[model samples]
Target: MAENYVLRTQRLLSKLPFSSWLFGKVISRRAPYFGTITPRITQVIPGKCECLIRKRRGVENHIGTVHVIAIANGLEMAMGTMAEASIPRHLRWIPKGMTLDYTAKAGSDIRCVAEVDQSAWQVGDMPVTVTALDDNDTVVVKGSINLWISEKPSK
Candidate 1:
């Protein structure tokens, strides 16, 4: 029954304009954000994804602005979803490395988007680049996430 439900959900999500909508709905319902840095997955495609987060007092740093780590979380959400959705269900992936660059301050809502060149993707290792932008449409943070993808070894 659970497998059937998963298939149904996947099918429905594929039909929609935004794949992240399903991912966000699922994650939010199962394990909602614990901090003020809540992210909403907006769209997901073969090699790209988008997510958003609203800045709040709870997410402020010492400077009284949106925290850098909070933006990183949003970037991860976007990149991870893109990488995971790229592979087939029979395969699995785990993040291997992440490099982050804080470019600017975030004072309002933020959007994180990620893209992976399909031609550059392989079954072994793939690099997904994610970028977070503030409400003004300026990049605040950038992340390069490495994912290790492979099939479950026979036991």
Candidate 2:
């Protein structure tokens, strides 16, 4: 059988120079809204994923800080990639909802991370922990993204 798409894509892109940028570009093409923050998908592995978004004018709010919504987009991207890379081939998953809290101001570039325990994959609702951290490693946003995991329909 072919490799999982998310895992395969990450492996292929990491072989190239500026792989993070290229990978994010490719993903944004597949999900156009993620392009709004110009994220760089730095990692996508089973159980975890990381995405980085620079502190740029486009993502800045009126107060000259990275907008919370932009950070949210990054978080969702990381969660989706992590789920896709980690889930068993027999399973399928989709986002059900998200609950986020803005804990601190995002004063610098942000790194969004999504993580799930290896044993957490099952046929049910799972809460994936996600966080957006500033360059100083301060948690600016903390949340859990709810995902519905189920057995894939028989072909």
Candidate 3:
């Protein structure tokens, strides 16, 4: 059976003292765009993932608030992690598209949580919901990422 890289990495890093930092480095190497937001995966399990991104100058907008794109990038990272951990080894997936709504100004560090249902594992389009919350625990952004799931080709 193919190993779930996301789950394997999460398990290995959980034993380290600086797991978050090392996880960020691993992600940065795998997905460079996610590095722009400096996301740290806090939790990962089948069907759910959570990540945190500090509000830094690099992610600031013209008005000094967190840029919308930065939040979106964080959300995408969360969704990708969830998908990677949840999908069966015989299946493959790709993000088809995303829809987002900015409800408030993200004035502080943000946490993005993404989740999916067992029904979403089928071969077809699946919509996964991802929500971003500020330090105060207020929802700042909400979105759904559509992923295309299909059986992996015979090796």
Best candidate, TM-score: 2
lDDT of 3 by residue, 102-144 (tens): 9999999999999998557989999999999999999999989
Q: lDDT by residue for model 1 over 8-53, one digit each (tens)?
A: 4556776777664555666555445512356667776667878788
Clash pairs (backbone) in predicted model 2: none
RMSD to the true structure for each prediction, in A, is 4.5, 1.4, 1.4
Ranking by lDDT: 2, 3, 1
Residue pairs of candidate 1 with colliding backbone atoms? none
TM-score of 1: 0.77
Q: Give the count of colliding residue pairs in each prediction.
A: 0, 0, 0
Error of 3 at 147 (Å): 0.4
Among the numbered candidates, top lDDT falls to: 2
Candidate 3 vs. true structure, TM-score: 0.95
Worst 10 residues of 3 by lDDT: 1-10
- Each prediction's TM-score versus the true structure: 0.77, 0.96, 0.95
